[model samples]
Target: MPNKHPYTTLISAANLLPNAQLENWVIIDCRHDLSAPEAGRAAYDAGHIPGARFAHLDHDLSGTKQAAAGGFKGRHPLPEQDALIATLRHLGINDDTQVVAYDAHGGMYAARLWWLLRSIGHASIAVLDGGLAAWEALGQTLSTEAPTSAEGNICAKPTLVASVDADDVLKNLTNPQRTLVDARAPDRFRGENETIDPVGGHIPGAKNRFFKDNLQADGRFKPGHQLHEEFSNIISASQTAVMQCGSGVTACHNLLALEIAGLHGAALYPGSWSEWCADAGRPVATGA
Candidate 1:
C-alpha cells in the first residue's frame, strides 16, 4: 500500500514575504515552453522572484528521454527517484520547509512539483494560488539574483510514494475502485488533433474531462461543489483515481483541479499515454 501524503491548502503571495521565506520556506519557479526548451531557464537567469529557485519542466522536473507512448512521446518523462531527491536537495529543501511552487502562466507546471512532492510522502508544499502571474499582480517584489540551495535533512521515504505501472493500468480495466482521466483538450482526446503526438487517441478505458473544464473563465479553479459534480459525472468519488495527459505535464492540471475540488487522494500517470503508446502493445481508443 502506498503511504498517504499530507498537503497544505490555500497559500497566497502575502504568505511568502521575505521574513517568512527566511523561516525555512522553499520557493521554486516552474516555467517552460514546449517548443523552446532553453527559454524557461534563460528567462529565469534574467529575473525571478527573490530567493526563488528554478524548476525547469523539460530538464529538472522530467526525465531526459520520452518513451514511445502517445503522451510524453519524446518530450518529457518523470525523473527517477534518486535523481528527483538530488534535484530537491539542489534546491535546498528540508523536512520543515514550507515549499511553494509557481510558474509564469499558471500552476500547470507548478502542480507537477506539488504532485511529485506528495508522491514522495512529503506534502508541506502548495502551488501559488494564481502562480507568478498573480503574485506579480499583487505588487510583490522581484530580483535578478538567484538563491543558493540549502543542505538539509530532507530524505525521501520511498514507501510513501504511490505509482501506477502498465500492469496496474491493465488490471484496472474493470476495477470499480479505479478511474482514469485524460486531461487534454476535447479535440485531442477525440483524435481530431494530432499536432503533438504521432498517434491521435487515448487509453481505451479512459474518459475525457479536459483539464480546462475544471477552470472558470477567470482562469481560476471552479467552486469545490461544482468540481465535485464534474468529477462525479465521469468517475465515482469512493474509488481511487489516476490522471494523465500529453507527456504527463497537463495531467498535473487535472490533479490540481481534483485537489482544489477537495476530492483528495489520487495518483498521476507520470508517463501518461506517451509511455503507454511507446509499447505499441497497449490498447488505445480514438474518435468520439
Candidate 2:
C-alpha cells in the first residue's frame, strides 16, 4: 500500500503538537495565486501553521516552462517523474509517512499535491480538511520561522496510477469506461462566463460539479454520505471518473471532493482546458 489513498483529517490547534505518532506525518503549506506568484512565499515568510513546509505552485510543484513535446503545458503540467521523485525525497516523504497538504482558503492547490502523490503511485497522502483557514479558525498558533528539514531522505516510489492526456481524452470522447467531470463553476461550464481561460463552455459530454458545491457554508466538505448521494447522480458508484478545471488547478478540488465522497480511482487532467486550447487541433465546445 505504498501509494494507497489516505483519509483527510483536521488537526486541532491543541493536537498539532509534535509527538512520536505524528512525527512521521509531513505537513505542507500550499498557498498560491496565479496573479501574484510571490504571494505564497511571502505569506509563508510572514506566518504559517507550525511544522509546515512551503510548497510553492510555480517553484516546488510544477515545471517552469512547457515541454517541447510530451511535457508540461499551459498553466501547470505533470512534472517529469524523476524530478518529482526528487521533490518528495527532499520533503522527507517516504512510503509510510502520512502526508497532509493545505492551502490558505481551502485545499485548492493543496489538492494538487494529493493528486500528484497518488498519481505517482503513493497513496499515503491527503489534503487537510478546511485547510489553513479551519486551523486558524480554531485559534491555532502560527510561525514565521520555517521548520527544520528532516535529516532522513525519502525513497521514491512512482506508481503512475491515474491520468488522461489530451489524446487520451480525445479517444475517450465516446468511451464509456470514463466520464469527464469539470470542476469549474456552472456559469463558466455553460459558457456564460469566460474570464479565466480563453475558451468557454466545456468538453462535449462532460458534467459540471463546482467543487464548491461539496463544501458546507462553514467551508468544510459535506459529510461523506451526502457526497456519495450528490456524486451518484452524475457518476456511478463503480467508476472513479476524470476531473478537470481552469488550467488544472481547481480540478484538484473535484478530485479532493471525490476522495471525501469515498470515490477513489479518479484521474486528474492537470493541463485541462488551458493546455487543451494550447493545441489548436483539439476541439472546443461553447455554451451551456
Candidate 3:
C-alpha cells in the first residue's frame, strides 16, 4: 500500500518506522563530511539504518566540475539530468517511491538529496528530521549489511524547485530583483574563515542566515510558524529570495526551511560564493 500520508518536506523517525519495510519506500543514508569525503561511506559501512542505501555526495549527488572561460563551477554542481536519473533508478526509486534521506548532520546533507529530487520533479521525497540520532533514540537497530533491489524505471519530469546561475546572481547585484540569503556560518559569511573555499567573504548583497539556525538544540527543524517568522525578518514580503552557500550544498537547508515556513518560489544559486568569488572581477562584501 502507498503511504497514505506521504512525506514531502520532513519525516519523523516514528512516522517512518511503520512504512520503512514497505516496497515502495527507499531510505537513503546521506552522511557526509565535507573535509573527509570518504568518512560518510566509512560510517555507513560501520552501521546504518537497516536496508538503507548509501548516497555519496560527490559520486551520486554532484556533477562533474567544469572550467569555464572565466571561473570554475562551484565544488558540487547539480548532476546531469540523465546521470541523476540513472542514480535514482540504481537506487530503486520509482515515481511513487517515498524517499527518506537521513544524515548525522542535522539533515544538512539529506536536504541536498531532498532538493535534488524536487529539482527533478520528484515530490515524494523528504529529509529525516533530527536524522540518525532520532532513529537510535527510538531504539532502532543498525545494520552493516547492504540491501539491493530491482532497478527502478523512474523518469525525469519538470523541476519543481527553482534555481539561478552566476549570471543571474550578478544581475541581481545591480538590478536588485531578489534578496540573496547566505546559509554559511556568520564567520564564514563575514570573511573570517577561508579554510573551505578559497574566498573568505560572501556576495555583496547576501544576508547571512546560517543553516543551523533552522534546527533546534535537538537537531530537528523548528516549527513552521517559527521558521516563517525568522525568515520573514530576513526577506521581505515583496522581495523574492535566492539561497546560496559555500559550493551550494547547505543552501538547500535554507530552501527546505523556507518550504517548512510556507515561503515558496525561493531559488537556489548552485555555484554560490565558491563560484562567485572564483572570478575576481565580481564584487565581494565583508563584515556583518
Candidate 4:
C-alpha cells in the first residue's frame, strides 16, 4: 500500500528532509501575495525547496470569477473539480502522493493547498510547519532548478471537508446553527480596514478569530494542546464551526489550526466576505 506514514495536517522541516527525495512525495511551493499576485511566481523562480513545483493561488488553486445572482462570485472562487484534477495531474501528483505545501508567510498560502487536496478527498497532504523560514533556519539548501515527473493519475474522490456558500451564510444570520468564525485581522473584521475587499465589516454574527493567532512568534504553529484550549474557548460543544476570510484563502489557515487542535468537522465558507458583501442587500455588521 501507499506510504504508511503520510502526513495529513502539518509536517516540520526536519521530518521532511529525510523523505524529500522519495518518489512518492510531492512538494509544492504556494507562496503568494494577495495584492501583488505575480510576486509568488517570481519568488519561486529565485529559489525553492528541492523538487518543489509552484502552484499559483489564483491560477492553480482557485476557480474562475464570474457574475452570480446578487453580485459577483468572490475574488477567489473554488475551482471546478476537473480543472483542479488537471492541475494536480500536471504537477505530477498521484492518488498516493504525500503532498507537502509551504510558503514564506507562515502557512497561510500553503494551507489553501492542503485544504484543496482534502476537498478532493486526497488525505495525504500536509503544510510545512513554520514554512520556508523554518526550512532555511534548519540550514537546508534551496534549489533553483525545476523537477519533472510523469502526469498524475489522480481523480476526484468524495470530499473530506465541508464548505458553505453565501446563501447558507445568509441563512445562518437568522437561524444561526453554525458558528461563523472570521479569520481576518481585527481591524478588517471591524470594517476599519477596507484595503482588501470593497466593503468592510463582516457577516452579522461572525466571531473574530484572526488566523495569525494560531502561529507562534517564530512562525510555527502553537502546541496542539494550547491550540485546542484556545479554540475551545471560541467554539463550544453545541455549535458546528465554519471558517471564513477575505476570499476563502487564509481561512484555510484557521481550518488547519482547528485540525491541529483536534477539532474536526469545521466547514469553510468558500466565498467568504468578498462574496458576502458583494450584494448591497446582504446585512453587514461592524465593530467588535
Candidate 1 on 130-173: residue-level lDDT in tens? 66766777787678898776575677865333557667887787
Pairs clashing within candidate 2: 3-122, 3-123, 4-123, 120-159, 121-159
Model 3 poorest 10 in a row by lDDT: 63-72
Candidate 3 lDDT for residue 92: 96
Q: What is the lDDT of residue 103 in candidate 3?
A: 99
Cα error, residue 132 of model 4, in Å, equals 0.6
Q: Which regions of candidate 2 fall more than 4 Å away from where they truly are?
A: 1-22, 70-72, 158-160, 174-176, 237-240
Which portions of model 1 miss their true places by more than 4 Å?
A: 1-7, 18-20, 66-74, 158-161, 174-177
Alpha-carbon deviation at 275 in model 1, angstroms = 1.1
Model 4 lDDT-worst window of ten:
64-73
lDDT string for model 4 (198-218, tens) is 999999988999999999999
TM-score each candidate: 0.87, 0.88, 0.97, 0.97
Q: Model 2, range 1-288, lDDT digits (tens) per residue?
A: 232444443333334434212667778889988888999989988888777888888877886557866654767777777777778777878767778788876677887887778766666676767777777777676889887766435555566457777778888876656788888889888887677777777877788888888778877778878988898888874255888887777888777777667787778777787787666677778766
The Cα RMSD in angstroms, rounded to one decimal, for candidate 2 relative to the true structure is 3.0
lDDT of 3: 0.92
Candidate number that wins on lDDT, 1 or 3: 3
